[model samples]
Target: MKKVFCIGELLIDFVAEKQGSDLSKATYFTKKAGGAPANVACAIAKLGGRSVFIGSVGDDPFGTFLLDVLRENRVDVSLAQRTETFTTLAFVSLAENGERDFVFSRGADKELQYNSAIKSEFAGNLIHLGAATALLGGKLEEAYGHYFFDGLTKKSFISFDPNYRADLWKNKQQNFAKKCMTFVEKADLCKFSLEEAQLLSGKEDVAEACRFLHEVGTNIIAVTLGASGTLISTREFQETVPSIKVKAVDTTGAGDAFIGCLLQQIAALTNTDSLAGDRDLLVSMVAKANKAGAITTTNYGAIESLPDQEQLSA
Candidate 1:
């Protein structure tokens, strides 16, 4: 199987135990290793797939803890970097329905510098760009663009997720959408939430949104629809794959798990390029990914909630 190189932020999530959206009122908290791309990396490794995490963290205890968690999950962290800046932190509050509100304190995660030596590793591998802070404009953004183009030049199987966080973008939604299109237009596979699909494509209808994304050049598109399951689309057909029913305790990393599972399935294929034409195979893959996502919601935290091969099979 080809290695999946997941690029993005690795941070600490201080989650409030209270069931309320207001972060201010929340007193007690629990620290968890969290980040969209990092979660995806752990998801792949825990499922017995070859996964590598490529990003930066602070040269501090929180960063050390995050790296330790990834290592314990069997994700390769040799490519991960550490800086003198403080580790990034996110304060989260969850509602009763598993929905969450977030506030971020940006830090060393944005300081991931590009390395020319790593460019050769992209060949015949899988590259996943799913960071919420990737496009926020810094060294990480530059490194992201470099890696993306290098992946394309090396014929890597590239996957992208906008990983849109409303709290981070605030009034910059238009800018965020514009920046995301650059990756969406060239990614081999693209994952999006229902809201992301609509916002990026400027189409409220799911089918139309998929069509728009296809026109822009993504060969395969998956739009996550929560309990309704995921809508998988290729140039030839579009279908909604069903997910197993589970009482969601937290929806934070569900999407990451879904994409991670899908990517791992793709990585194991003998011919990754042929995925777009095989409708039955695509449906089956998405179905498994749906289960991964649903299972994640049954627990708390991102990496800790990811299902392994045993859990996925059961």
Candidate 2:
């Protein structure tokens, strides 16, 4: 399999136990290694893929713990950097149905500097850009833009996920959508949540949303529809791949798991350029990715919930 370079934030998520979507009321909390790209890296590594995590964390214990978790899951963290800034953190409060409310403490995650050497090494590999904190504006965002353009020039298979967090954007949803379009317009594969698809594409219908996104430039689009499964689309065809039934404990990282598994399968392909025309293969990959997502919902913490190849097969 080709190497998958997952570039983004790596943070500590403080999840409040049984808290009903109100961070103000949450008392008890547990820390877990989390971040959209970090979770994707772990998901790919856990499934026996060559996964590398590239991002910055604080030179603190929290950062140490996060790196340790990635190493334990077999995710290559050699490119992960440490900075003097404090590690980023998100305080999450879960509702009864597993939905969550989040409050963020931005920190070292925004400090990832662009490396020319790293950009040069991305040639002919797979690159996943799925950071929630990336667009918040800083060195990370600059690095993200540099890596994306460099990947394009190097013939890397680029996948993008606009990991939207309403809490972080506040009243700037329009601005967020605009920033995301830049990536959506160039990515080989784009993954979006139902909400992200609607917000970014300005279409309520899933098919219409896919059309809008494809017209912008993405060759492949996957819109994750919670329990309804994922809507996989290409210019020629679009279909909803079914997900396995499971009582969701927490929805966090489910989408990451889905896209991670999908990318892992894509990385193993000899020619990703033909992926858009191969409907049967696309459907097969999405079906397996759905299983990975469903399995993630059966447990709590993001990285901890990811299933291995043996578990995926069973």
lDDT of every predicted structure (CA atoms): 0.94, 0.93
Per-residue C-alpha lDDT of model 1 across residues 1-314, encoded as one tens digit per residue:
99999999999999985468888888888999999999999999988899999999999999999999999999999999999999999999987778898999999999999988998999989999985999999999999999999999999999999999999999999999999999999999999999999999999999999999999989999999999999999999999998999999889899999999999999898888788999999999999999999999998898899999999999
Q: Per-residue lDDT for 228-260 in model 2, tens only?
A: 999999999999999999999898899999999
TM-score of each: 0.99, 0.99
Report how far residue 290 has shifted in candidate 1, in Å: 0.3
